[model samples]
Target chain A: MAVMQIKFIDKIGEGTINKIESLGRIALFFAVGIIHIFIKPFQGKKILDQIVFIGSKSIFVIALTGFFTGMVLGLQGYYSLVRFGSEAALGSAVALTLIRELGPVLTAIMVAARAGSAMAAEIGVMRISEQIDALRTMHINPVRFLFTPRIVASIFSFPFLTALFNVVGIFGGYISGSVILGINQNVYMGTVIESVSIEDITGGFYKALAFSVVVTTICCYRGFYMHLKGEFGARGVSTATTNAVVQSCIFILIVDYAITFFLV
Target chain B: MNTPLIQLENISKRFGNLDVLKGINLSIYQGEILVIIGKSGTGKSVLLKHIIGLVQPDSGRIYIQGELLEELPSAKIKSYQKLLSYMFQENALFDYMTIYDNIALPLIENPDVIPSRIREKVFILMERLGLRGIENKFPAQLSGGMRKRVALARALITDPKLVLFDEPTTGLDPVRKRKVHEMITEYKEHFGFTAVIVSHDIPNIFNIAQRIAMLKDGGILFEGTKEDVFKSHGKILNDFEMGKEI
Candidate 1:
């Protein structure tokens, strides 16, 4: 019985050590990648290419999701506010919810699902295929060649995407509240304009920026270090991609909560 | 003879519970084609990786041009790395890049490189390597043999002082393999760059190899001229040269 307990404790200790090591590695990876961005010999062309891939290509999905999200919020908010005879305030509620919370969070989640997974898979494939090693031999910094541009693109992309989501979401709310529910259009627009402050907008942008860093860092880290994870070949790449998306999503929510807590 | 372009002293590497390279000591001379022959899973690629600084050894010292690799500053290390180019066994071409972009990547990344010069060099290499007219095609769009040649072109594009070829002729037919060997010889003669090749094409590789190193059981078993190998070991080297699993 004593031996069993000792063995169990030993196993737990080993797992804890491994987790700590992994966290340290990820933190170092993110730091080095961020440092590379500010170094001389900037990757302007590659950064532009990534901006097109991560930002321009994501517009359709962001618009679609934003519209539906705001519609749902308008519909749901109207029904609930009506119970208190406060349905006239439906626009403020939808605007605030979309701007303060759902806009950055959902946009990040969508981008994580779309672009983050692709980044992980792309870098993971490069890792397994020894392309990253090839870059090293050619005197190219792999982090600069691969991760720096993606991180820079994400930084330039996320807030713009969030802003787009908020604008489209407000339009969706207008469609559902004024057009469908017969609410006074002027009243709805008035309340929406009145309720949103500069703080709310800037706060949302801050969240977008934070989530972008988290998502890009985690995804790139997973892929760049896939070889060190004791996995190889296609299966390793697939596993790394899945883990990148899942971890990004989880961290998004966690970061969202933490930011909201501090902001509120 | 000339302070050995690269030297490995008592190098050892361990992956998990397995010892990949156990106390390996070898020297590579400048301007010579040294082919390392070994069985599969015998750490040939790992040894090559150490020379290129891709894999750090657990216990060892590597000297580049009589200077300890580990003791060099980061800037010096980068300069040394710039002097070397590695061709991966699997032809690690960027699948998303066109053949032109793939061959020109090193130069494109170099801030000192001129745009016109990059195009000129890339086109010349493509023509010489018979990769013309396919410059716009991605690596995945090319055949295996064509992809190998593209990789070779990319490796040679920088005019590196030391070129590491990891199984450069692995997936080629006998004729293509011989052609690749001929190309390596021709290019080596023209450019005068030192070459280190890891291959299993024993007799065929012998044609271009100025010196041969046989790696077995995590250490170098023999290191000398091809004639030295043939003359010294009647059975072991003969079996290895015959593609027998020793």
Candidate 2:
């Protein structure tokens, strides 16, 4: 039993080391992908197509997430305001929380779960079938030829998406407070605009950037190195996609907390 | 004569506990076709990977033009990458790209190769390989023979010093296999590039290989000229020749 315990500990240590090494490779690939943007200019149509797929197609989900997130914030803020005998401060509370913390983090988690998983699966299949190797043999770095454009598009698009989320979320809170809860519209808007600083908006943008980096890096890493050998096929690709989504969602939450802790 | 262009000295590789290659040693001069024959899972493809630095050996050394491969940094390794091309067993064509884009990929990615020259070379190679009209078609739309030809065209686009073919005729019908063999021979004659092909197609490959290396149990069992291989009397070779265990 003692020997078995020792072996278990050793296995855990090895697993930890493996995770660290994988994360290091992910960082390296992310840097390589960023550098590739300047080095190899792709066709404009390809870039535009990716933008449409990743950004425009994602708007509805982001808006839906924002609406629910704002409603929850308003409900929670109203209860807390009533406890403090300051119901008028509900608008300020909702605005501050949404712009500072919930907006970017929630939107990123949703998109990463939905779109990032599909990207990983597609690329993972490409990797397993030697399509990535073919690209290498053809003289194109897979990072440049395949991943960089997507990464760049995500970097630009996610922040814009986050901003859209914040806007829709604030409108959601406005509808909930002014129309349903019988608060004045002018006062609600004024309180929200006053309570949320430019710094808060900037912080959300920073978090969006970090979340973009995490999502794309994890997804691309899982796809690019799906299996060490060729044994795993479609099943492996599916596993990689699931892992990418889950890992990136966890990473976004953790990084959001860390960034908010430091910035706010 | 001139210190063989490529050399493998006691190269060994392992995946976890399973040893894939056990001390492989071989050499090939420039402009020669060396066919490697082995049953499935005997590391024939693994050996080809080591030649181009796609898979590194656990021990031993590989030399291309006498420069030790493992010692070179990645930037230098990439310089070597440009000089070699590998055609995967499944043809591994990028399914998303059209045949023309797939063929043009290597040329477009290499900074030294200009676009106009790349276009010219791609069209010329397409004509040569009988892929002239289907340049815009995706790999999914093309027949197996055409996909193999596109793969060949991509491999040759860079004018690599060495071209590696992995099971080039494994899935094709006999007629398609013959056409592929003819293409291989024609390309070898036209470009004079060194070719290393891994195949179990004994009867078909015998005509193309100047020399043949037979591998079994993670090591080379026999290495000799085609005539010598046929004349040699060993159970493994005899079984392979008789199509017993292939």
Candidate 3:
């Protein structure tokens, strides 16, 4: 009975240590990748490719999300605010929600789903195929060759996407709040303009920027250091992709809370 | 008489519970072909990887051109990488790149070279490899043998001082295998470079290697000339190509 208890405790301890080691490695990977972005020689072509993939390719889905999100916010705001004769504040609620939280969080999560998964899959394949070793042999640093551009592209582009999401979302809110719900159009615009502060807008942009870097870094880390323990084929690639997207989504939410805690 | 191109001294590497290489001591001379033969999974390729700095040893030291590899900073190691390149057992071509781009990668990374020179070299090598008109095609479009040849072309394009080949002829047909042997000889003679090949193709390797080393259980069991290997006695010597026993 004592031996069994010791064995169980040992297993738990080893699992905890391994988890901590993985987290430490990820933190180190992110720090080095970010530092290299500034120190590494700029490759315009690679960064542009990432921007095209992560930014332009994502606009359609983001627009659709923003449209529906805004309409929901408008309808909900009308229903709730009308209960207490506070429906006049519908524009403020819509703009604040779109700008302050939903815009950054939803756009980032979408990117984590689409571009993040693809990036992880791509890098994971490269890892399994020994192409990363080839890059090293050819005197090209794999982190700089692969990760820096991606991280930079994500950091630079996600904010713009968040802004686009907010714009589309606000338009949806305006149509639902004023056009459909019989609210005053001029008052809707006026309330949003009057109530939405620069601090709130900038706060959203900050979240977008931070979330972009975190999401991209997590995806790249997952892809580059693909877990080869379980299996080592197509299944491994799929596992890495799924893990990257899931981990990136969780990181996005956690970082969202942290950024909000300090900044907001 | 020339300085050893690479020297491994009491090197060891362990992957988790397995000791992949143990107390390995080997010297690769300049401008000679040294073939390492071993059973599958005996760490022959792992030894080659250590010389090129892809996989660092757990203990002991490696010297390339008289300087300790681990002693150098990463930037210096990277600079040294250009001087030596390894052809992986799995071709390792970038999937997204075309044949032309794959072959042109080294030159593209080196800022000193002109585009015309890159184009000239790539085109010449492609012609030599019978891949001349398919520059734009991706690796997935090529057969395994063709991909291997293309990988060979990419390895040689940089004109490194030493070229490492891991199982150069295992999966190849007779004609392609012979062709690869010829390509190795031609490239070595043309460029005056050393070759370190790890293989299990006994007869074909005997045709090219000045020295042959057999590995077993993560250690060297035999090291001698091709003639000396046939004359050697032991369980390892009796074993021929790919688990064949005589």
- Most DockQ-accurate candidate: 1
Instruction: Pick out the ten consecutive residues of candidate 1 chain B with the lowest summed lDDT.
Output: B233-242
lDDT of candidate 1? 0.92
Ranking by lDDT, best first? 1, 3, 2
| lDDT by residue (tens digit), candidate 1, B1-246 | 679999999999999899999999999999999999889999999999999888899998999889998899999988888889898899999999999999999999998998899999999988888889999999888888899889989999999999999999987899989988998899888888999999989779988999989899899988998778778864786787767777
Instruction: Report the lDDT of model 2 for residue A117.
Output: 88
Clashing residue pairs in candidate 2 are: A138-B106
Badly placed stretches (over 4 Å) of model 2 are A35-49, A71-90, A180-182, A228-231, B70-78, B233-235, B241-246
Q: How many residue pairs clash in each candidate?
A: 0, 1, 0
How do the residues B196-234 of candidate 2 rate in per-residue lDDT, one tens digit apiece?
A: 999978678878989889888899888877777778835
How would the candidate models be sorted by DockQ, starting from the highest? 1, 3, 2
Query: Which sections of candidate 3 miss by over 4 Å?
Result: A1-9, A228-230, B65-79, B111-117, B127-130, B233-238
Residue-level lDDT tens digits of model 3 in A1-264 = 999999999999999998899889888888877777777346778889999999999999999999999999999999999999999999999999999999999999999999999999999999998999899898877887888889989987899999999999989999999999999999899999998999998999999999998889878888898854465779888888898898888888898899889876
Give the range where candidate 3 chain A is weakest over 10 consecutive residues by summed lDDT: A34-43
Clashing pairs in model 3? none
Residue B10 CA displacement from its true place in model 2, Å: 1.2
For all predictions in the order shown, the interface RMSD in Å is 1.0, 1.9, 1.8
True contacts kept of each: 0.96, 0.63, 0.81
